[model samples]
Target: MAPGARRLATEVVLPVPESGDPVVVELGAGAGVFTGLIQELLGGRGHHLAVEADPRLASSLAARHPRARILNDDASALPQLLAEYGLGAADVVISGLPWAGPDRATQRTTLDCVRRVLAPQGAFTAFGYAHATRLTSARRFRRMLGSSFEEVIPGRTVWGSMPPAFVYHARRPRPRKSAETIDLLAAQLASRAAAATDMRF
Candidate 1:
């Protein structure tokens, strides 16, 4: 809701790699506060795609960070969007979205999408307000985060933020198996089923 402090932005983008051409994605990139910082950190190396559902905000963010790909679409569609863009998976995902506001289903689905789109070694980051952690949605989000990834680390509270928030740096998401693995397994199962049917015939 609030434009995050620069310090907060710094903490949020900590997972971004300094080396190589990383596929970085950002969700809920409101007003491009974190977007600009990410772009600066990237230094024009990686493909940065920022998803902002709000058309106006997406447009503004696109204008501000022309180098970054700003999409006017829901964050839940991240996997499909990556496929459409011909990218394999995200190396790092930084979210500025408010987890406390979204319902339980929304939270689960979005995080699942992120996990599916993440590379095996990818990292994900999202923030929560300290004062709001006791709320139902916020508490549920924390639990959801824990369940979503193999490792979820809550960073120190950013006193500079308007309401004092901490970032959750998650790694090694538990997205079942890679898409290639799933496809291969499906093909193998179908082959086995066909062989059994032929034998019965």
Candidate 2:
């Protein structure tokens, strides 16, 4: 496992509450490192979902974290998955996605997904390397997150892990749009694009 991945797993385990039926979701769970830690944190008591894009990792997570429902899909599909499980919202969402910087598209999609599945005042936590935050990519990520989430706060650094790491903690706000709203917006955009193309012809 990579040093950054280890640090992120540790970060996820630190802030979880000891009791309560907290619904947890983990994105980019590569190699089951963070997935296993999340399972341990939950103690097989609550609903846990692990989303991994890699089939092999998803399979490994399914075998290792039997308590967790492994979803072999993209992070963007989170909202739909939560609905399928009848989960109105998640108490926490942990992410360890590898990106060069804050991806606006991903930020928007993920924030939308989080809002749909996160309960009011629920937290969304993700980590990136400390060195990456110093770069321009990190700045963009922060800006994107600021626009999407109600409160974006930086968490403590994981010093024991390699290269060091910092976690971003954001709380979901109330009165947010549903996943259906986002789907409608996407359809509207597609319709507009198709209309423009027809006009050109």
Candidate 3:
């Protein structure tokens, strides 16, 4: 495994419990290294959804981790994919997605997808190369998560793995107002404004 990959697996496993299994979703599971750790963490007690974009890797994961449901799909489709499995939400979401080369828009979309699938009180954890921490995309990624999540914390570094990495943990946002709710209120205001405008005319 690559240095970053190894470090990611180790970091991802840190927050998981040894018992009282929790439903987990792993996005961008490259080669099942982290998947293996998650399996060990859960001890075959909870449900795991391993989402990988690569067909070859997904197939390999399905074979190796029979306890996990492997999905050969993009991370952006996480919400719909979880519904297909009859999973309303997950207790935790682990991401090994690469953020080095991606633009800010792509990063934002990825984080939004993660937010959509996270359950109340659930967390989304991911690791990025330590060197890439200064990049604008990385900063924006952290900012966007911070805006939506109640808490955004950085965990310990995994020095054993290559290039080193830091884990980012974020808790789900409390419901102040959902998008649908905001839209409805906006429409009502617009309607009232139009009525007033008509009366003025």
Write down the lDDT of every candidate, Cα atoms only: 0.86, 0.74, 0.79
RMSD of each: 11.0, 7.9, 8.9
TM-score of each: 0.84, 0.78, 0.80
Off by over 4 Å in 2: 1-8, 99-102, 174-201
What range of 10 consecutive residues in model 1 has the weakest lDDT sum? 178-187
In model 1, the number of clashes is 0
TM-score of decoy 3: 0.80
lDDT of predicted model 3: 0.79
Which numbered prediction scores highest in lDDT against the true structure? Answer: 1
Q: 96, model 1: CA deviation in Å? A: 0.8
Whole-model alpha-carbon lDDT for candidate 2: 0.74
Q: Per-residue lDDT for 177 in model 1?
A: 51
lDDT of 3 by residue, 92-155 (tens): 8998888656786687677777777788888888887778888756765666666657788988
The stretch of ten residues in a row with the least summed lDDT in candidate 2 is 174-183
* Candidate 1 accuracy as lDDT: 0.86
